[model samples]
Target: MTLMRQETEEIPAAVARLLSSAPETIAPVAAAFRAFDPHVVVTIARGSSDHAAYFLKYAIELVLGLPVASQGPSIASIFGAPMKMGHAAALAVSQSGASADIVAMAKTARAGGALTAALVNTVPSPLADSCAYTLDIAAGEEQAVAATKSYVNSIVAGLSLIAYWANDKPLKTALANLPEQLEKAEALDWSFMLETVSNAQSLYTLGRGPTMAIAAEAALKCKETSVLHAEAYSSAEMLHGPVSLVNRDFPVIAFAARDAAEDSIVEIINGVIPKNPHCYISSDKSADAIQLPFIATGHPLTDALALIVPFYRFVEQLSLHRGLDPDKPAALKKVTVTR
Candidate 1:
């Protein structure tokens, strides 16, 4: 815990402890919504959680085939019209479970007859209060100003819901092994990311499976810690229009996983590496073939494990490479409040 805590002041050791909470421990949460066949899902969150929402949305849709949208705080705060509420269930993701505007939005969705849920670290919070179901991240107390364990845990929890809801056997098995994979990812060397990302003007993180959310998480780390202009996209989406522009000038980060989409995603990576040539890769396998395990999420825990490892290292190292303190980010705080 000290090794995890020493890197950032606001981040406490207890928060990192949440990483090991078994998903099966929260099996009751998955059981609670067994009856719900939501037409769509709308996620309400801020900053880091919002980014996690993006990845979760992609994962749920890719596997469950249910439409999912992440509401902008402004959209839910000012519009007053509940779009996600009309036909979909609402999932509010927060570490604090106290963001005023997102809570308000989730309440609005609940009042509109849509089912509601909260993925949170805090118990007895406004966000949890508003939803009928609460999927506790059980990440315990997050001590770091920058969210590490809770954010990853929330993504894992959400993926569990998606996997269970879809009831895809192979996908479920892959996700179940995620926790071990994450541990492996944590041990992988990431010194190269610091050396490489410093000189790049722009970077891209690409993924397809639940790892698409991993790409988004990676991009957030790049910007928050290093001030790099980084963006994430689905591997297929990157090849659609953005891929044409990828060349030697850009460094591409691929979030590869053991999902059905791996082959096509690998193909997309093949296409980009030849063009951009500055490819950074993360996985839960031997570092021999790819760039090595950049983070811990590549371990058996699929989404959850990957959530902890690759992006955390990316952010931590990017901070070191730039001589910036990871403890306090530029113009950011432990909790974000919206109007």
Candidate 2:
């Protein structure tokens, strides 16, 4: 088996480990967040980590009712601008905790008076040092360049932190049950997408709210592992302009979690099925679009997060089917440090 496939299978256990040790690692960060009580939250990350931030952004906004923004690392690393973050809190998500610019931005956020925290797999790395609070995501050594477990664990860490901060029992219960759900998620069959993805040159992924972030991550994984060109769009935004790109030959996968937006997503999928018959959706509510089985995590937020596991499994198989190596994508390293 490929390293990517092995790592993908390991995700359930990784998340379980992270959740089991949450009190020792994540609780302190949650305490800090509760104490700070910032007016706004800003996230610092890139690539898959950035996608995790996007997921957390919706979670923070919907649950805590605090607006979250993505802060550009270049503000400190390139332009060297002084940020006024006195009323803000910063969350930096990194798998390696070694990116130079991410480290710089974390330092800048702390200096600028934001209650800075980091969720990282690498415990003693520079990015962790830069932040006032650091929670190791505890995904273990992720050898695959595509980052299956680390990405999942990063989001899990952030969600756990949020749950502790708000004392949200329901969210906590959902998280406690996430490991079993994730195991089922890993076992799900998404092989139907392999033939379509292998044949197609390009496709679109659609989601709303937290699932939009999952869609973005899915698109990136397609590009990274299979060398396929894929783009992610919000179901709402696709109607505006990108819907013009959808045709009979074009494939679309809409990720609809069991949330307030599920009905709207199903409607969007129904609208697209006429123009593109090769469409798939995660939610079973869609009658026309091909339904992809998903593990419902009870909470809307975690239900979105669970969608990625099967995608990871499918993409790994797709990469191998295309005679490509999922672990070592062309021109991509495991740990990218960009300034």
Candidate 3:
């Protein structure tokens, strides 16, 4: 059994841990958000953590109507440039919480008059030390070079904070039931899409709204573990120039949440069916595309996180099928510190 597979199965328990500890761990962050009430929000992260930030970007903007943006850590880590972030809030995410660039960016956000917080696995690490509040994702120690439980927990932490801050009863209720939903997600089989891409050199992942981050994370995992080149695009964006590459047999995985975007995403997937026969989509609604199984977390936001669990399981198997080790990808490290 590879570490990646082990960690992927641990996602439900990890999420349960984060949820059970939310009252104490996330209360202060929610309180700070209510009190600070910043005009804008900014996120600092890299790689998988950055995809978690993108998920939060959509949640914050859609739920609270506060505009959110991502700040490149290189600005502070390399150029030593100052930013005008007064009256803003910053959210930084890292599993290890030791990246110098992320730490520097968090420090810069604080110095620029922002209320900064972090979601990290290691509670007392440098990035956590630099923030006003740090919520431990509580994913335990992930041994896989490709992150699974940590990424899911990071988004859960962010969504929990958003739920409390916005006082969204539906979202809060959905989050309370998330552990079970995530467990259901783990059992879903995406092997049809896996078999389709098992021999392909490249593929395209499509999604809209918060699930776009799921698509992005899925694409990254394909590259990291399966050694396949996968590109992520919004269902709308893929119709532009990217679809030109799609032939009758080109593989495409569309992540369609059971939210407002579901109909549109299904429509787009149906549109692609003429050009690509290997298109697989995850949604309850049917289309010309192949239907991949998914769990419908009661709330739209939590639905996004649920989709990744099955994908993680699929990617782990796909990697092994491609003669690669999912536990250790090529040219990668567990903790990457960039400055």
In model 3, the number of clashes is 0
Q: Report the number of clashing residue pairs per model.
A: 27, 0, 0
Q: Measured by TM-score, how close is model 3 to the native structure? A: 0.98
- lDDT of residue 307 for candidate 3: 91
After superposing candidate 1 on the true structure, give the runs of residues whose Cα lies further than 4 Å from its correct spot: 1-25, 82-87, 163-177, 239-249, 283-290, 294-308
State candidate 2's TM-score. 0.99
Instruction: For each candidate, give its TM-score against the true structure.
Output: 0.82, 0.99, 0.98
180-242 in candidate 3: lDDT tens per residue?
A: 998899999887666679978789999999999999999999999999999999998987899
Error in Å for residue 229 of model 2 = 0.6
Which segments of candidate 2 are over 4 A away from where they belong? none
In model 3, residue pairs whose N, Cα or C atoms come closer than 3 Å (at least 3 residues apart or on different chains), thus clashing, are none
Global lDDT of model 2 = 0.93
Candidate lDDT scores, in order, read 0.68, 0.93, 0.92
Task: Flag clash pairs in model 2.
Answer: none
| Model 3, runs deviating above 4 Å | none
For candidate 1, give the lDDT of residue 201.
87
TM-score ranking of the models: 2, 3, 1
**Candidate 2: deviation at residue 68, Å?**
0.2
